[model samples]
Target: MAFEGLASKLQETIKKLKGKGKLSEKDIKEAMREVKLALLEADVNFKVVKNFVKDVSEKCLGNEVLESLTPGQQVIKIVNDELTKLMGESESKLELNSNGISVIMLVGLQGAGKTTMAGKLALKLRKDNKKPLLVACDVYRPAAIKQLQVVGKSIDIPVFTMGDQTSPVDIAKASIEHAKSIGCNVVIVDTAGRLHIDEELMDELKDIKEYVNPNEILLVVDSMTGQDAVNVAESFNSKLELSGVILTKLDGDTRGGAALSIRAMTEKPIKFVGMGEKMSDLETFYPERMASRILGMGDVLSLIEKAQEAIDEEKAQELGNRMLNQEFNFEDFLSMLEQMKNLGPLGKILEMMPGANAKELKDLDLSQGEKEMSKIESIIHSMTLEERRKPSIIIASPSRKKRIANGSGTSIQEVNKILKHYELMKKTMKNMKGMQKGMQKKMKKGLFGKLPF
Candidate 1:
């Protein structure tokens, strides 16, 4: 949804190469120019665009456009590969010392979700069987400590906070001591954010780093800030020698420039991304999947990776068989949705795609629907096992709809929509499976060819 515009644009461009027997110099040059303009219009960084286009040209030029392929696809593949390389080859992982307490210091600009990300990391660390303690080092923002407290409470993790009365350095030192006392192995210290580049903020962070001797110094940056974020990252790296970045607000209207430029600019790999404000919305950054999404190719790799991380292999295999057999139901739908949350927020997934801007995804704002989904899940959970296996039984029971709505804190209309969508998906998948072979090949070719005047 977020990538519809970008998808259309790229598809239009790639269409020209659909049936080409060979590519001339003119064809490659013209196509590359068009791609350059598109990237610029999409708000990609100027220098990044230049370097990317050049790299793609160098990699793809003079290569034969095979009899079965068009020249455009060759360029697209090159671009995708280079983009992946530019971001980083493998997924970055935050190091945690197993033998002793691992301290992480988080620094970022104001409103970059530093406090929320701290709690998310703590939750992830906890799930990994490590005893994680959250340190509230933000002695600046009045509500920052309370925000961390709420996040910590929701995740059931310990919060080491001194409120706004103490210095951040002192608080961080005390927090590490507290972690030792409590036998916690991980301490994620959430530090203060500044409005802009300021000595006070840097000095404060430097002091905290010196005192805590953190294992990881992660800089959280807003992806929507674009080039500004690159500048901030550069500054932070120069001052603190940051280990990595945590790109935040990626669910918003962002051009992806920050993600593309930060690594090249600061030489620090992005370890994670904060997709949403929810405690479960943080995710590990994967460059290849992101490259695929940006190129409008879809990211099946990320989907597979997420499934592996959150769902059992046997269960997922069973679900895949059910899908192939057109037996996907509400039960399967609920499981997939829950697994998706573990991957990252829905909005962030959309943003990772080329055409999935924030504006087109306005209707897909899941934050507001959190309560509704919870209720729907509860209502579904309350249904009899037989009813869940066979939704048709509930369809005949009109009173069942009202009962579920009331029990789940939703309206009858919401329940109906879910049921309708579920049925429609089943029917669609069934039809798709039986579709004619080579239909995709025919569809790839234009229905009409233009006349040469």
Candidate 2:
């Protein structure tokens, strides 16, 4: 959703090229012109867009593409490669000191969501088997320290605070000693922020940097600010020599200017991006995967990673076996539904799939789909344990269907539809089982002989 407008425009331009069997210079120029306009409309830096178009146009006109059998696909690959290079080319990992404690100081303007990112980073570190201590160095804003404490408590991590009476510089200096005593290997300092950049804010941040000698100084920025976010990163880099950047609010209706321009402008990699408001929504930045998503190629790797993190492998295997054996009842359906919900929103999952039409995705009413799932879940919940295990009983008894409808606040017709669908699924599974057996018999008869097992 971050680059909805830009992605749509770029995909449309590429689709035209893909339709052609041979690409002329005129076609490449027209496509590049459309791409240039799209990037400018998305609020990317003007100079960056100019250079990007010039480079892409030169490559498109080359013999390697113009003379190729699959010229259209070749052009798309060039664009994808250029886009990846424009962003960071690869993921940038955090610089963790394995020998001793590592300090990470977060700096940004007010409303950039630094405090929340601190907690997210700490939780991620804990999952990586590190003991993290959150230091509340933001003493200027009202309730800043309290907010950090609440975030740390929610994650079951320790927080170090010395109240508003102490200077942030001194607070950061002392938090390290506390971390050492508590055996914390990572120290995250949440520094103060101003509404705008000023000498006063820079001085305090620089002081903290000098005192702590932090291994990483990450600047958290709001991606929705467009070119303003780029300017903020430039100013901070000039002053503090920032190690990297973290873009927040990426899940919102942003034009994606900062994400596309920051690395080329500042020569710093984006370490992470805030995808949602949940504490677990922070994701490592992957430039190639993002370019693939923008070009409508999808990102299957990230989707697989999310599924691995959210679903239990044992439960998944058991459910698969049950479904193939035609033993999948309402109870298994309910369990499967819950597991799918853990992999984030349905819209996001759809976006990760290859060949998903952009216009169709935009027109889809995903909230309606969510409501339907809730309806199905409620209907399943209203059934008795025996009825769930053996759906035949519910189908045979009209009174039981009426009772379930009343309990779930639905009509009898809806209940009947669910029963019909379940029966259809079981029948399909049985057909699949028979087909598999037939294939095995054919293999034993030497029809397929000596498979590469």
Candidate 3:
């Protein structure tokens, strides 16, 4: 969503060459020119775009176009392939040792969401059955430790801290021992942050790292700082010898330069992304999925990955079939709604879409959404079991809407709108399901399917 305008422009510009029988050097040059302009307009690094365009032009011209492949198609493929590789060839993951408690040190500037990320990663690892101990190593600020404790408790994990007097290095060392005693398989040290990079801050972080000998050192950077973030990441990676990075504030209206530039500059695979303020907002980094999003094609891979990570796999598979059959009910609807919350806030999801602009979606904050969604959950909670399972009957009862509106502190119109939207979505799903089934039948008859050769 960060580069929506740029994505739309590039997609439209490339569509002109999609079905061409042949492409002259002039045509290729024109397309690259437009692409370079689009990237710069998106606030991407100017140098990066120049290099990207030059590389793409050389790769496409050097490639021998197959007789069956149009020159335009061949050029597009080369660009896509190179774009994917520029980000990284595959998904990057955090490495954890099963032999003992793996310690992870989190470092970054103030307001970069370093503490919040520590809790999010702890929760994510805990969900994977790894016992995680949250270390409150950011002791310079009085509330920093409290923040980690609060996040840890919300996710039912334990926080390791020793009031404010102890040095962070001491606290980190003690936390490792505490982790071993508590059977926690991982210890996450949430380190202190500064408003800007300074010698003292670097020395403080380095001291803690030396004292604890962490398995991984993650540099968290705010994506909204544009080129500054890439520079900050490079500096930290150079001084600390970081294992990887965590790009925070991705759900913000970022300029797209930082995310695109950091990877190229550091050559370090981004391990995770912090999309929102919630404890469950961290996600593994995937280059192919991000490339698709940047291209404005809709990132179905990341969407499905989020769903798979949050929902019960077997239950989700069953719900998938029911959606195809038009048999999905309010029960399934409630589950789906809850599932969205588990992935993170609704507004954050929209902001991450390749076509959604951060500025346009700035008002869609996660804190505001929590209150609104709680009200909806309360309304749903007030319903009787039978009423929830048979929502059509409840909507038909004129008095029920008024009762729910009052009970949930909402309006009658709100309830009606929700019901209407649900019905329309179900209808669309059924039609798509029918169309897919018909295509499958044709394919099985040997009269369909694209020829591989």
Candidate 4:
């Protein structure tokens, strides 16, 4: 959803180009002109847009692209390449010391989500077998230290707080000794953020940097702030010599101007992006995959990674085996829904899919879908164990169906529909398995023999 507006506009422009069998110089120029306007309308920096359009236009005009049979496709590729290059071409890994503990200082303006990001990063590092210590250096903001401690507790990570009385510089220096005592391989200092950039704030941040000499100085910027986020990154980079940047609120940034322009403007790689408020929502910034998504191409790699993280492989394989044997029941259905919930919102998951137009799904009531899922879950939960294992009993007994409907607070028609759908799913899975095994006999037997439908 981050780049929905920009993606829709760019995809529309590319759609027209793809429709063409051949392209003329004038046609390419016209398309580039539209692309330029699209970028500008997305709130991308004027200078960045100007340079991007110029670079894309020059590449489109080259004979390598123009002389091709599919010139339009070639031109789109050039745009994708330029977009990837605009953001850093590859992932900017955090600078971690192999032999010693790594200290990372998070700096940003207030409301940029520095504290939350510290927890997110710690959660990620913990997954990599690193003992991460979250240091609370945000003494200015009310209850900032308490906020950090709360975040650390939720994730089961250690928090090193010196309270609000100690200076941040002193706190930062002391946190290292704390991390060493606790055997923490990584220390993430959640520094204070101001309402706006000021000399006092910069000096305090500089003081922490001088005291700790952190391996990575990450600037957290809110992507929804547009060019203001870029300016903030530039300012921070000038003073801190930032190792990288982290774009927060990216999921809500429909225009995505900051994501598109910050790295190019500040000459700092965007190390990560906060996709949502959940601690697991923080993701490493991948420019090529982002460009692919912007161009209406799905990010299959990220989709797969989400699946790997959310789904249990053993359970998945066992479920598949049971489905193939026509043993899938309401229990398995409930388990599948639980796994899907862990994958995040359905709308967000759909966005990562190829050809899933974010604009088209913009009007979809996700909460309504969630409510429906809850209703279905309640209906299933109301069923007896035997009824859940063998839905055929419910199909034969109207009284039982009515009892379940009453129990789930629904009508008998809805209960019957669930049974019918369950049978359909069972038959469908058998057919799919039979096809996978290249056995027509199994498919034929499963298709028309015992199924009530």
**Could you estimate the TM-score for every candidate?**
0.74, 0.94, 0.78, 0.92
In model 4, which residue pairs have backbone atoms overlapping below 3 Å? none
Models ranked on lDDT: 2, 4, 3, 1
lDDT of 1 by residue, 1-453 (tens): 322344345555655754466776677677778777766665667888898888776666755543326566676777778888878877988877869889998888888878888888888777779898988888778888898888889889989987799888888889877999998999998888885468877888889889888889999998877788888888888888999999887755345667877887778999987766677667788888777776666666666655577776787788878886877766886786676556665555555545443334545666766666666688788676777778887778889888877877777888787788778878877787777435765665545344343
**Candidate 2 vs 4: which has more TM-score:** 2
Write out the backbone clash pairs for model 1: 2-355, 2-356, 2-357, 3-355, 3-356
The C-alpha lDDT values of all candidates are 0.76, 0.92, 0.77, 0.89
lDDT tens digits, residues 49-77, model 3? 88889998887666474333677667656
What would the per-residue lDDT of candidate 4 be over residues 1-453, giving only the tens digit for each residue?
Answer: 879889988888888988888788998889989998889988999999999999998889899887889877897789999999999999999889987789999998988899999999999999888889999999989989999999999999999988899999999999999889989989999999964468887899899999899999999888998999888888888888999999988898899899999988988999999999899999999999899888877788999999999999999999888888898988888898889789998878888888877667676777898888888998999999998888888889989998999999999999888888888988898789878787777777879889886
Mark the regions of model 1 whose C-alpha exceeds 4 Å error after superposition: 1-8, 64-70, 308-453
Per-residue C-alpha lDDT of model 2 across residues 75-161, encoded as one tens digit per residue: 989999999999999999999898899999999999899999999999988988999999999888999999999999998999999
lDDT of model number 3 = 0.77
Candidate 3 clashing pairs? 1-353, 253-358
Between prediction 1 and prediction 2, the one with superior lDDT is 2
Model number with the top lDDT: 2
Please name the candidate that would achieve the greatest TM-score relative to the true structure.
2
Question: How well does candidate 1 score on lDDT at residue 230?
Answer: 86
Evaluated at residue 431, the lDDT of candidate 2 is 94
